[model samples]
Target: MSWIFLFFAGLLEIGWAIGLKYTDGFTRPAPTLFTIASMIASLALLGLALKTLPVGTAYAVWTGIGTVGTALLGVWLLGEPATATRLACIGLIVAGIVGLKLAA
Candidate 1:
């Protein structure tokens, strides 16, 4: 259950991370509100997960998910470069996340 919460929290982190670009420095009201809501929800979910998960493992996995999702979304939606090296690094992050989950 805590892992589920952490996973969703990580997803929300990706939402807000990508939402920042849509917010246009927060000049856009709707995106800004959405981003802010996501931020709060993400933190709340992270707190819930922290009740059982080790802080180090949870934090790394949370940020890892966010980083990977955001980078992929940036390439797919924002026309960012998807270089081989960049993708390999993302894969490494995913591996680390998996390793942490297994260790925990």
Candidate 2:
């Protein structure tokens, strides 16, 4: 299930992104280890997913999902700004991801 692998890859992408925040420029050992582990896991799953999925489709979906998820996480959990323009852009990214999948 390449899509399943892609889903897990997306989740791990979120993990790695949050871990990067906690890593404090790599000064925090625990978060740094988490960052490295999550990165490995994310890449591993992405590679597996790519075995069946077209590379362009897989990559676009992976990155779109990861970016949107991470940006939302930042806004919600980390108190990052969420301007209307930013929200609109995020919506566009999601729409594009959906369009690509539809085309695929």
Candidate 3:
């Protein structure tokens, strides 16, 4: 259940990240609201997951998932470049996240 919470938390982080792009420095009300909502959800889930998960490991995995997910979303949804180098970096992030989960 801790892992599940972390996963959802990570996904919420992705939501916040994408919403940030549309927030225009928080000037736009709707996107800004989304950004705040996602951030709250992410933090809440992280707090809940910490009840059973080690803090350092949980935090690392949480951040890793969020970073990679948001980067991919940027490429696919926002037309951010998915060049060879970027893809390679994304692959590395995935590898690291998976490795952490396995080794945890």
Candidate 4:
């Protein structure tokens, strides 16, 4: 249950992270609101997961999910570069996330 909460929290972290770009520096009202809502929900869910998960592991996993999702989305949607080295680093982050979950 805690892992489930953490997973969704991580997803919401991705939402809010990507939402920042759509918000256009808070000038866009709808995206700004969505971004704010995502931020609140993400933190709330993270708090819930923290009840059972170690802070270090949870934090790393949360940010790892966000970073990976955001980077992929940036490449797919924002026309960012998807270089091999960049992707390899992202893979390493994924490896670390998996390692942390296994350890936990």
Which candidate should be chosen as best, given lDDT against the real structure?
1
How big is the positional error of residue 39 in model 2, measured in Å on the Cα after superposition?
Answer: 0.4
For model 4, residues 1-104, the per-residue Cα lDDT tens digits are 98999999999999999999999999999999999999999999999999999999999999999999999999999999999999999999999999999999
The TM-scores of all predictions, comma-separated, are: 0.99, 0.94, 0.95, 0.98
Best-first order by TM-score: 1, 4, 3, 2
Displacement of the residue 17 alpha carbon in candidate 4, Å = 0.8
Q: What number of clashing residue pairs does each candidate have, in the order they appear? A: 0, 0, 0, 0
Which lDDT value does model 3 have at 50? 96
**Candidate 2: lDDT over CA atoms?**
0.92
Lowest lDDT 10-mer window, candidate 1?
Answer: 57-66
Best-performing candidate as measured by TM-score: 1
> Which candidate would rank higher by TM-score, 1 or 2?
1
Computed on alpha carbons, the lDDT of every model, listed in order, comes to 0.98, 0.92, 0.94, 0.96
lDDT by residue for model 3 (16-102), tens: 999999999999999999999999999999999999988988998899999999999998999999999999998998898888889
For model 4 the TM-score comes to: 0.98
RMSD of each: 0.4, 0.9, 0.9, 0.5
